[model samples]
Target: MEDKRAAVTALPALFADLVRCETRLYNALNDRLREQHGLTTAQYEILRYLHDHPEARVADLATEFAAGVGAISKGIDRMENLGWVERRPNPTDRRSSLLALSHNGSDLFDAAQKTFTTRLTELLADLPALTTVARTLAHLRTTLEDRRIGLPAG
Candidate 1:
C-alpha cells in the first residue's frame, strides 16, 4: 500500500519535470531560430515537414503537428505571404490544396537545420543520460500519439 502511494506521487512529479523540460527546450530553440533565421520554431518545423513530405495539405500538417486546422491554416497563410510556401491545386481534391516548399523556403530550411542542430547540441551536451531520456520520451510520445490523448481532433 505504501509502495503504491509512493509510485503514484512520483509519477506526477516525473510528468511535471517532463513538461518543464519540454517548455525550456522549446523556448530556447525558438529563441535561437528567431535570432538566427528570423523564424519561429513552429515555422521551422512546418518548413522542415513540407520539405520532407512535399504536397502535404494543411490538414495533413495540422495532424502531424498536433495542431488545430485553423491554427495550421494561419501559419500556412503567413508562410505563403512570405513566399516560403506555395499552395498548388490538389488534382484529386480540388477543395484542399497541397503545400510545397518554395525555393526560398527550401534555402531557409537548410540554414535553419544547421542552426537547430547546433543549438540543440549545445543545450543537451551536458545531459549524460540523454540517450535514455530520449528513448523514454519517444516511448511516451508514441503512446500519446497512439491514444490520441490530449491532442485536438482535426
Candidate 2:
C-alpha cells in the first residue's frame, strides 16, 4: 500500500520528465532539420507522412498531427507554394482535394529521412536502454491511440 501510494504520487513528476525529454529532442531535431534541409520539423513530418500515405487529404494530416484543419491547410498551402506538395481534385469529394508530394518534395523527403535517421541513431546509440525505452514509448503511444486520448488539436 505504501509503495502504491508513493508510485501514484510520483506519476506527475514522471510525466513532466517525459514531456521535458520530448521537448528537448524535438527542438534538437527541428534545428538540425531546418539547417540541413530548409524545412521545419512540422513540414518534414507532413512530407514524411505523405510519402508513406500518398494522396492523403488535409483532414488526414490534421488528424495525424493532432492539429486543426485550418492550420494544416495553411501549412499545405505553404508547401504547395514551395513546390513541395501538390493538390489534386478529390474524386469522391468535390469540396476536398488529395495531397501528394511533388518531385521536389520527394527528393527533399528522401534526404531529410536519411538525415533524420542518422541524427536519431546518433542520439540514441549511447543510451544503454534505448530499446527498452523505445518499446515502452511505443506501448504508451498505442495505449493512447486505443483510448482515443490525443493532444488537443492545435
Question: What's the lDDT for candidate 1?
Answer: 0.94
Determine which window of 10 residues in candidate 2 has minimal summed lDDT.
145-154
lDDT of 2 by residue, 91-124 (tens): 9999999999999999999999998888888777
* Model 1: colliding residue pairs: none
Over 4 Å off in model 1, which ranges?
none
Clashes of 1: 0
Each model's total of backbone clashes = 0, 0
Deviation from native of the Cα of residue 10 in model 1, angstroms: 1.5
Displacement of residue 125 (Cα, Å) in model 2 is: 1.7
Residues 1-154 of candidate 1: C-alpha lDDT, one tens digit per residue? 9999999989989989989998999999999999999999999999999999999999999878889999999999999999899999999999999999999999999999999999999999889998998898899889988998877865
**TM-score, every prediction:** 0.94, 0.93
User: How far in Å is the alpha carbon of 121 misplaced in model 1?
Assistant: 0.3
Q: Show pairs that collide, candidate 2.
A: none
Model 2: how far residue 119 lies from native, Å: 1.1
